[model samples]
Each structure stands twice: as structure tokens, then as C-alpha cells.
Target: MAGESEYTYVVDFDGTITANDLSLELAAYYGGTGYREIENKYRRREIPIKEWLRQMVALLPPDLDQLNRKALEWVSIRAGFNDFLDQVREQKSTVVVASDGFGFYIEPILKAYGLLEKIEFVYRNETVTDSDGQLKVINPHAHKICPVCGNCKAAHVVRIKETGKSVIYTGDGSNDRFGASWSDQICARDRLAEVCDEYELSYSPWEDFYDIIKIEKPDLKDCSDISLCLPQGQGIKDGI
Candidate 1:
């Protein structure tokens, strides 16, 4: 086995590890046509992910068990994830999953696949039934003042880096940009790749975790100057 290293992989849960986005699948499955309206707003950048979750959750049914069951039935782990975990374990590197999605189903899905224990931590939002008996989204991981992402993935990356671990942020959504910008290296795909290109951030395009395992660790650099948000500060760029 390779000896332990200073690398920590901060991965996205929805589209990165899974072949499909479970949150989107759940919302579309239960939210009916309303899912498109909210999704379009997020894609157009009119609303941040935090607002997206709030609006999307309202469209979902309040039954958590039913929702989780559907999620378990629909989720498919992407190819190479198991081998990637084995490689990470051999190298003694850390893995953390961060997501801005519905959040309630993450653990259940991971546990179902027996992958939950391999992860060092998971940062995500929660969907709960409010006192009024409505399903609502709660973000304990969000920035106190920043209403951008429900889960501040950038903050998670910054925290890991503070522990002297170099982070490799891997994701496939536009909302992942903030966190990816703070990471030492970025493994981007789909919308996240486009965002990285638009912002002039260097990233490696990947199709699956197998490609991720082959990526070389980059030299640590100060990414704050090019990063989108300041995790230690207000969490968003000016005018955003």
C-alpha cells in the first residue's frame, strides 16, 4: 500500500459519484412540471443553489421514507467509484462528499451501496417536515450571511486545506465552481467544466473516478486571487 499523504479529495455527490443526479431525479419524479421552472432559473443564474433547494423542496412530497425508497431504487453509482475508493484507501488519502441538493437521501444511498463508511465526512443540507407539516430544506452548513449555496462546499475545502491537506475538488455542476476554485486541483465535468473554462481556472476534465485516480497532484498555490468566493469571509463575490 502507498503511504499516507497530504491529499484530501472533496467530491460532489449528485452527478460526480452517481451516474445521474439523484436530487434532480427526485425533484422531477415528484415535483412534476414545476421542477423545470426552478431548474431553469438556477441554470440561468437568476437564483443561487440555496434558493433552488428552498423552492425545489416545497415541490417534493413531505414523506421522507417514500422519497428515500424511490431514491435508493433510482441511484446508480458511476463506474470506477469502487476501485477509486480502494486506491484512496491504499494511499491513505481522505475523501469528503459535499452537495447542495435535497440532502436527505445522501446517507441512505451511500449506506445502501456500502460506501458511506469510506468517506471521511459529508457536507449537505437536510430536508425535514416542519411544524406546519410541510417539507422544508434546512442548511446547517451554509454560510451565516451568504445565501448562495445551501451547503458551502468552498468552506469545506478551505477547512480541509487548513489542516495542511491539499484538496482535489471533483464535480459536475455549475454550483460546484466556488468549491472547485478553492481547491488545489479541480476535476470537472459537464457544467462544472464549462464554468471552469469561463473563469479561466485550470482543471482536468474527467468522465469517471478512474480518470481521477490517474490525475497528478499539483503544486499548492494561493487560489484566493482567482477564487470566486472567500470562504472565510462573506462567501460571495461582489455584485453576485
Candidate 2:
């Protein structure tokens, strides 16, 4: 039974865990006028995500500190995530976050919410400032043959699945399609749900972590916590 329950959860950070897309939000304000066109292109599938990201990042101001500050100020996470993490930790489940965005802002934001240490690994583009103060993106997990994503979430899932643990993937974007397809179980929301529908892939749809807990892992639903669970009718809030 112990071996049967061993699960590794690969979650998406931006939209799945958070209520809003942090990078897109930041890019809207800081990415200048050129960001929108690239975003549109990506949305239309005229440009691949990797190139779209490159064009988007090129429009930013190269101030990592300011970018971090804006994210801390504007970004928020989905409700009940801490409790979800609590349950995962209690079960000793491995949790990994795969993002199509940058980690420069993700680290600080998670630290602020006290969730940094709970996450085993974060797979995303490494954002660094050059000597001239220009931002550079380094993708260590990119697939040589795949041109879509800067970091291949599917590849990570495949590797984790090789270890004989069930891989449960949670995400809410078009980019999540590949990874979610390879997972043993999928919890999808928003756009990813539509993708699942289009492909006829089985998935659990959720509004927030509360839905995820109530629907997928009911055993952990009654688990106790103050900030993690809310009274009936108060409704769940978004983000950390």
C-alpha cells in the first residue's frame, strides 16, 4: 500500500498555482509595446513558445530587482495551496513545478509566501542579468528536437515516471498539454481543460486547490489548518 501510494506531482506555477499569469502581467506593464504583438503571435500559434518568450523577454527593462518587486506586489497564488502542500508533505509526495516562464521572479515570490522550501524542484528558464545589465535567459532543460517550449515539461514527466511513481500533473495552459498528456493523472483548469476536451484526454477540472482536494484526493479534504481551509460561504481566495 505504501508503494502503491507513492506519487510525484508536477505542477505548473503561473496559472495553475497562481490565479493570474505573473509573467504576462509583468510583461504587460514592463515589457513595453512590443510584448503584446509577440503574445498575440504565440496565442495564434504563429510563433512557438520558445521564440515568443525570447521576443517577450527582449522587451523587458533588464531590472531584475524591479521585476521581482512588481511580481511581489501584483502576483497572487491560488487558495488552499498551502494546505495542498501540507497534505503532499504529510504523504511524502514529491512536488515539482514546471513553468514556461522565468525563475528570477518565481523564487522570491514563493519565498515571500513561505513555499520555497516545500517545492523539491522548479523547472524553468534561468533569468540572469548580463554585465551590461541586460537580462538573459538560459534554458537548461530544453529539448533539442522540440521547438515549442523553452523547458520541456513532458521530458521531466517522462524522467520522473521512469522511477516507478505515479506522476500527477496539474496545469492550466496550452503549454501544459504535452506534460499533462504524459502524466498518470491530470488536474487541469482554464485553457488546459479546453485542450483536454479537444484531445479527449481524461482530466479533473478544478477552480482552485480546494477543488483539487475535494475532487481528486478526498482523503485529505478534512485535514486541519487555519489559513489553509476556509469556512463555508466565505469562498476561496486566489494566490499566496
Clashing residue pairs for model 2? 76-239, 77-239, 77-240, 78-239
Q: Estimate, for each residue in 1-240, the C-alpha lDDT of model 1 and write its tens digit.
A: 122588889999999999899899988887888999999998999999989888988888889999999888988899999889889988888899999998888998888889999998999898999999999999999998987989999999888888777889999999999999999999999999999999999999999999999988765667889999978998789943
TM-score (all chains, Cα) for each model: 0.96, 0.86
Candidate with top lDDT is 1
Model 1 TM-score, all chains together = 0.96
Local error of candidate 1 at residue 111 (angstroms): 1.1
Show the lowest summed lDDT stretch of 10 residues, model 1: 1-10
Q: Estimate every model's Cα lDDT from 0 to 1.
A: 0.90, 0.76
The parts of candidate 1 lying over 4 Å away from their true place are: 1-3
